[model samples]
Target chain A: MTVTMEDVAREAGVSRALVSIVFRDVEGASTATRERVREVADRLGYRPDQRARQLGRRRTRLVGVTYAVHLPFHGELVEALYAAAAPTGWDVMLSPVTARRDETTAVESLLDHRCEAVVLLGPSLPSRALDLLFARVPTVVVARSVPRRTVQVVRTDDAAGARAATEHLRSLGHRRIALVDGGRAPGAAERRRGYRAAMRAGGLDDVALVPGGPTEHDGEAAGEALLATSPRPTAVLAFNDDCAMGLLNTVRGAGVRVPSDLSVVGYDDTAVAGLRAVSLTTVGQDPDALAHLAVTRAIALAEGDAASAEQVVPPHLVVRSTTAPPP
Target chain B: MTVTMEDVAREAGVSRALVSIVFRDVEGASTATRERVREVADRLGYRPDQRARQLGRRRTRLVGVTYAVHLPFHGELVEALYAAAAPTGWDVMLSPVTARRDETTAVESLLDHRCEAVVLLGPSLPSRALDLLFARVPTVVVARSVPRRTVQVVRTDDAAGARAATEHLRSLGHRRIALVDGGRAPGAAERRRGYRAAMRAGGLDDVALVPGGPTEHDGEAAGEALLATSPRPTAVLAFNDDCAMGLLNTVRGAGVRVPSDLSVVGYDDTAVAGLRAVSLTTVGQDPDALAHLAVTRAIALAEGDAASAEQVVPPHLVVRSTTAPPP
Candidate 1:
């Protein structure tokens, strides 16, 4: 009555070898063949044995990554992760979930793939979801703050980065400054906190905080709103470069001169920040270091290292032509 | 004796069930167990019979994609491809290969994965590569021209787009113009041919062609070269938006004003072209439409549809604030 590879293969109309290949996740079998083999095995009430397999091998050498944010910078992070992991003979597989898919579903999907360890980038998953994932697999969270003792966390200092931006503007003698904030974004709350703290620290507590989203469109809307204020702020610190670029465009379209009439600063020095046309002043996070640390920590946890609660990375500023003294 | 799942399970010291899960590529097994199973199987010289397994199942709904270009726009294209294909019950698996990997090797890698069909993005592979691939599996190419009679091709109309850009500037009373050409890029030859033909057709063969590359750095270099020219051309047409953004930055740094002193036009109306700061006058190609077409054609080929040699999509131009009459 026990299910056999032959039984499943026969039901799926494939040879036992083909079924084995599909199960092994080896290259050479077409995607169609793999899908068919998995379906047939599932139908035949088949299950794979794990404890024996582990005893036979030293390591799985597979890392799973789940990313909720698809910003262009994430692509760079993914590339960096590949570079960091590849030399160590580890392969990274990505499973991306949109807003519609909850964190549990995403984590479960990675678990389904038997990922040795999982990394969640800017995850919006609840704390319970993190606890569940920690119980099932070695889990690492990037840019998410979780109080659970079981999970490992890696994050850039968003609050500090925000404060740096605000201070940079304040040092330029801009009294009436504004922050185009990333409203309800993953790291928005921490960034807002940083901005508030910095404003107070710099004795510019009256600085405006404008609500915005993560996209360039939101930046434009925020820029338009800021322009409507009775006394326009001389300097603006945007949530990120995308928003800054949007704000730049909207302000320029309204015939405002940059660095003379208005000085703009952005965050996350993406490739666009360095573009000749944009040349945005912004905050920089070492994406390469962040990726390397996440993967190395994930591997350590997979190898049975005790989990740590947090890994915090410092932030720095990259000044270009976007900010100037108020005229 | 032919290698068996029992042998793999036994070697791995995992239960047959664990081996099955690992081999099936299912979710439940831990990463450690899956790696072990695969390692043991590899050591035992196991090769799964993919064709046999596929015959058992009606079809495997997986598509394989190999991206040769790493530009951000290419990432967007890949994303679009995934979005277009996912709705049809198909999932995409990526095969990471370097530019050094020849077309034959690339195709072989896909074959090893048993991809139902393959999509090559901006492949550097020659026509013979397409011939070799068509022999084993159905294939579609994006942004590459292949002379093979059997392989399907999808590309944007680079020539027409270039013409529109040239005409736009000419109509705005710009007599002295220059082109920052993308030398030896995949579509560069077509774009260059388009630019030359358009200039000749408009009775303006005196325009300069400055050699360039695909990167923003290249654009900066081109901008420097153009600036050094005597009575510098009133307008410059860059290879793409990235290059244009770079040139714009470089020229602006040199104290030249866009539109008033020097008009700049770019190709590939990617998301960058629309940013408020970089309101580039650019040639537009519908990436969504192109992605939809590429996926639809790829699926058709996988379903055994008769293969055609090539498919071309038209390109248009979007006039933003970057272009104006010469001062």
Candidate 2:
């Protein structure tokens, strides 16, 4: 027969209440009693009934993280979060909110698991849905910023990153700069706003903005569009590294030399940017640092410290082989 | 006072047993009764006390997945598993096991959360640890082949995939081919055996074997080593896509043209392989299909279908711009 908590208490020569307190690690149980109970329980091969304990405690210590689509760097961030949370005795659960599955269902499904907190990465959920989710659990929104103050936000400063990219190009004497805008993606809007703000601030507001997506194909399309322009921008600022790669290949395929014919800048200095073949100049965000901050803030909120609601992380530019002064 | 199950039952004009059966969606509950209970609960704004219900069932419908390291593709597989399991009313929890935290601690931590089953992805644990895990709960092993008959196994046909990669190179007029090996990884041994068998079968047993790892840096190092050989290999088969990319970059950096000076083949046609810039010739394993199969099989095992212990999925090769006739 399977052993019970009562059996464990009898084996340890302790009262059932003491055994309960020790197993639960609740206050009022002395360290000596706790250690003794654990020793006897280990010797007896006793494991607390998880369901019973969870019911009594009313918390799961499980947090749900949802991503809109599958991207490699996004996966890296999730891995970082997992590494950060594991040491804190919390586990992260994944839920992919695809177009087929609406945001409400995703949030409801996580709620059903009794997760004490949630972290949404590049979520497709509308603001109302986010408001509803925040009402249900302590939530940390990553890679996206919402207007509400109820939810905590953790994101790389896209506007500042974009400005740095523009200023880098300007410093290289590239007066004719082009922006490949990532249309309607979670971070795209903020990035676009940053690019525009930076261009205007740098007296380059006349620079063209080409509509694009986050994929390399978008970069290719943007390259084609730029090539057709009467006077192609000597330099291009792509949406992200993937898009920059697309632009690089497209330009190279057309016999255009990088940094000689056209300088290019990418964002999210992913592994691809540092590749010897692709040596892309891009903006870098420390995923590990961001993940640590988000998870730490989440634990605090889960532990009932709800006053801290927002945190912003800074981004920096990494110079590589892809950028040079315009000829 | 917070509303209880009894309060919900009274409000719905149903017995407490009927309310529970309806909420749990037990097989015995009729559709009409289920609909009535749900409507009443919704109207009364009654949210089921998840903790209390979790206690009664002794199952959280949560499955914990543990990974030794966070490789890019592992993230895709985890996301796929989450998407697959969430629809079936099961949530996928992640436990990132580090060198500091052993497999036993990770497994026990999941057990403490009342996970219905556990899946270990590319675990580095010894067979004895695996045996202990399987004894505790329904367990599934992914990307690893274990000798134990009790634990269920889900893995790609790496041997077959490697054989196909080698044959593809041989068929393309490549006589001097080298295999960049993934040393000591779970599936690496099997893949190495396959490559050797295929080379011998093709009457090319004289081919070189270069030691490597799953990372791009490893690929670059292998490329340097191959370049040092007297008659450098005209064709290279890398351990995986990331490694292949590294090799491509390193060779190109040394002024070698891909498919002209060296034809390259990669294993695991990940999303990066499909990128226009990479266009990597590699082996393809359907991550979504594998994840779906693993989760379904795990749930079945947890639900008392312990008869089947192993399931194998086939791998296919995808030819892209990277492979051609040897110089």
Candidate 3:
């Protein structure tokens, strides 16, 4: 029950092509024709579609971002991305991936908004799926690595981060260090490999790699698994901050004192880990630097520059109250 | 030098109106004209704008939600909203408010996307600004109360929630209960009033109101102030979970055990509050029910149903490891 462009064209007695030009604000129509079309369109109650009007014009200068709503780290990165994009004359459009919204749906919304480029924050999608996105739009994947050499990437060296966490616990006189692995979670394999390599380098070949996920509940379950293991580890390096927090909490609740009984180190020094109550020793990813690089690459690609290279940001270990010399 | 629709029309030897029809997939253009326009558009690489094509004649069926990216509770509510919108044949579009993006910009982006209605999650904007938006679009404000009778609001009874938290502390046999007030934050005044009312009803009219903000650092500072008081309250209610966690950590570090020596309670039972280590007893705002109500009202308003009414959902207290009978 809505008025179409055809209706306006017929009423105005002009070609539909002329009306399209007037609405698009392009150079095809004369000023008189433009005014006439506008009058007729207004008379017909044509609700102007911004996207239609802006099409074939200059750039929208919009950068789309897809992030998981539940991840606190993603929240921090999104804040950093906004700061990064502003001075560069670009606006950020967020399409959050919630429980009911998938990455494809979220990404498509951004494209629908006419965003020139997209920055995907640690997406857990398959390589084939990413190839499709890269083919369609200029994409920069953050916090996760992609296999395709042609895809641009801005991410942390997950293996190095896990190594730093493992080495920190080892330096604190912790001998039996166990890794709470992230299983198939993004960067999990790299983290697991990093932990194993660090332990082997420390001359502790026997590794205790317990399966964990990206949630606090997973961390709690992993903590129980650790408690049940015959030779309890003196220290544990968790997949991420949430898991580390859960593990730390469960062990404490079971009468095991942190730093005295178990030295726990978490990845991604999220805001929660720094709380006085948690004070989790964790690895920190540089959100600002990573975001800056991502936007830089995205803007370059959007402006018709080639960007098939990857930029790796280093992670730093933050020693907090949760980690100390193993008893 | 992006290919415009004018170029496609000229290349296809068709009127611009006919080209627009072909691209929009709407009636009025013949099969031959549509095929010719499609062939020309593909050859010219005229990137079709989705939003432009989905205009008029029918609904975009999009419900836009504005939420603060930094809030964990907001994250939960957004997930709930997505689930609520999916069943009603409506898609959810997210515009996250970060440090760089304000509420105005967020809402405007939604409008630009041609969303039928907008749902703002606890906006701290002035009433006058909201009136401007209300005049332009169908808006529903969630988790925040507006004084305007005509504004549609779906929110928790914050005063009742605060009162429930205070009453729970009093029932646990704590006499000197201090209220850590969220100074100038959204719903702070109502919460303060509720706390005061509960205190006055119990004949504990000499209220210990501590100035606090919504962060963990604020709670730590409030905890220091509480420790310095001559007769420190046996129980304290914080502005939020983050503040309560900070206060708990600081007090415990100062050799004051929780619940045994002092009791602590918080508002907004975020994910972190439920952790066994930070088992914060806090008030729960039902995101599922609130999201359902907000979407239902938004769809109604979008469908021409007038809604100047406010719906207040009740909040329940979640008793966790943080609260116990005061010694």
Candidate 3 lDDT tens digits, A1-327: 446678889999998787887876779888888899899888887755555445544567788999999999999899899889879967787888987889988887787667889999988788788888888788989988877546688998899999988888888888899999898887788898889999999988769989899999889989989999978999999999989878876886687888899999998999878877668889999999999999999999999897767899999989999888988
Top of the candidates by lDDT: 3
TM-score of chain B of each: 0.78, 0.89, 0.83
User: What's the alpha carbon RMSD for model 1?
Assistant: 11.1
Q: Relative to the unseen true structure, what is the C-alpha lDDT of residue B257 in candidate 1, on a scale of 0 to 100?
A: 90
Clashes of 2: 0
* Model 3: chain A TM-score against the true structure: 0.83
Candidate 3 docking: what grade? Answer: acceptable
Ranking by TM-score: 2, 3, 1
Model 3 spans with C-alpha error above 4 angstroms:
A1-50, A58-61, A111-115, A148-150, B1-49, B54-63, B88-91, B111-116, B148-150, B299-307
User: Each model's DockQ?
Assistant: 0.12, 0.44, 0.37
For every model shown, the clashing-pair count is 29, 0, 4
- How well does each candidate superpose onto the true structure, as a TM-score? 0.75, 0.90, 0.81
- Score chain A of model 1 by TM-score against the reference chain A: 0.79
Native A-B interface contacts kept, per candidate: 0.19, 0.38, 0.62
The most accurate candidate by DockQ is: 2
- Among incorrect, acceptable, medium and high, the docking class of model 2 is acceptable
